[model samples]
Target: MKPLDDQQQACRDWFEGLRTRICDEFEAIEREAGSGASFEFIPWERTDEDGTPGGGGVRGQMAGKIFEKVGVNVSTVGGRFSEEFAASIPGAEDDPSFFATGISLVAHMANPHVPAVHMNTRFLCTTKRWFGGGADLNPPIPYADDTADFHAAMRAACDAHDPEHYPRFSKWADDYFYIPHRKVHRGVGGIFYDHLDSEGEAWDANFAFTRDVGRAFLDIFPAIVRRRMAMPFTDADKARQLEWRGRYAEFNLVYDRGTLFGLKTGGNIDAILMSLPPVATWA
Candidate 1:
């Protein structure tokens, strides 16, 4: 595989910048709670099967009084996908080699009333190139107002580029973030989309949209966290949060494409599995 081109580097830089800002904001949140916690950064490298330099990434993680557990990571990697996985990825059917850059984040709140959230966006190139990712809310104890606010932010981000985005992507999230065996949704959906192929001007448009999605998340989620983080919680609420986290665990381990992709590409195991909650319970 060849080195990243100018456009690829631009995308990678944006993702890394987002990661830095997010980590800083999260650390501020911890400080406000009178907790001395802050993200511990760990750096790691990637190598292709033949031991060629593939890229690497930094993982930032923190467990604080209010935020419980959160991970924000940015990575740039390129190499040939495993033969079996190549058959499944778009554009990789003909050429298994691919380049990918993105930021991924998952936050699990200490207060059950405060929602757990996930957001990620990426630019990928194989025989073709595209952008894919979205954000969703997962509250153990559902609150109508919070759900509405989250959707509103996502909708505004979508509406900026194309009016059709919210409806299309929100429904896509409803379908994608589902647990088939349990016959239940993973959470209240925000937006989920993938394989947004970049054709001609589409690259610029899609890249702009992807950046807005990140901005929307950075804007709204902290507000939601602040609103609920100080609220009281009972034993029952904590129990529900644990049970809900089990479902989250199941979805990531069994169905998350990002997890599979990372593992297949020989990504850092700790960084890839950082999405899992710090603790969870089945019953």
Candidate 2:
């Protein structure tokens, strides 16, 4: 594997550390639910087009009484983008070389009352460098209070850095996470941002904001999980959750950029697809 520069190494470390914290917190929730489940971490590698080693990462997964399925992945990968793909990526058209590090997570709860969630943050470098990611809540059975709490946490994270962030990124999420064909949204919107240039000395603030987003997610999500994980649900509720999961699956497989990026860059199939719920029903 190629040695990462200082910025790359620093971002990579944070992403990995966040993964550890999230996995531990999730395991604790499982224990509280009277399950002894822990995350099974599988390390995987990536190869560049020329067969050179690209950096890889751990895919941490767990199944428990509360969280039916969850995956938290951290990856630091560097390689040259394909010529066809280069033009679409910022700063990659001239030089297809790039590096990216981030954490991506998705949780599917066993109980319908508990909301499913997604959180991700990434730093990518080409001729330019930038940070991007966001968190969104997906509840099969929506609760006004839970949705308010989740958005409040995300807003706090965004407001801490810049007042403009919450409104801008929240709208971005609403636009980005929509299912055009279905004429509906995938979930309650959060925030989505990209091309947050990390050029020059802008790294510190941008990186700090990214860290804050992760921290906000860590702070809020587990609390929500605890609140609803033990709630009783009927077969009708289970059916609703499964049917909603089908929509989740369709979005990931079709419109999710991270999914396409992972596939195009030769990321581990299971890790890339882990965002898909374990069981989903159509029709």
Q: Rate the local accuracy (lDDT) of all candidates.
A: 0.95, 0.94
Clashing pairs in 2: none
Task: Please provide, for model 1 over 66-174, each residue's C-alpha lDDT reduced to its tens digit, 9 standing for 90 to 100.
Answer: 8899999999999999889999998999889999999999999999999999999999998899999999999999999999999999999999999999999999999
Query: Model 1 Cα RMSD, Å?
Result: 0.8
lDDT of 2 by residue, 1-283 (tens): 6689899999999999999999999999999989999999999999999999998988999988999999999998989999999999999999999899999999999999999999999999999999999999999999998999999999999999999999999999999999999998999988999999988778999999999999999999999999988888999999999999999999999999999999998899999999999999999
What does the lDDT read for residue 1 in candidate 1?
38
Lowest summed lDDT over 10 consecutive residues: which window, candidate 2? 1-10
RMSD of each: 0.8, 0.7
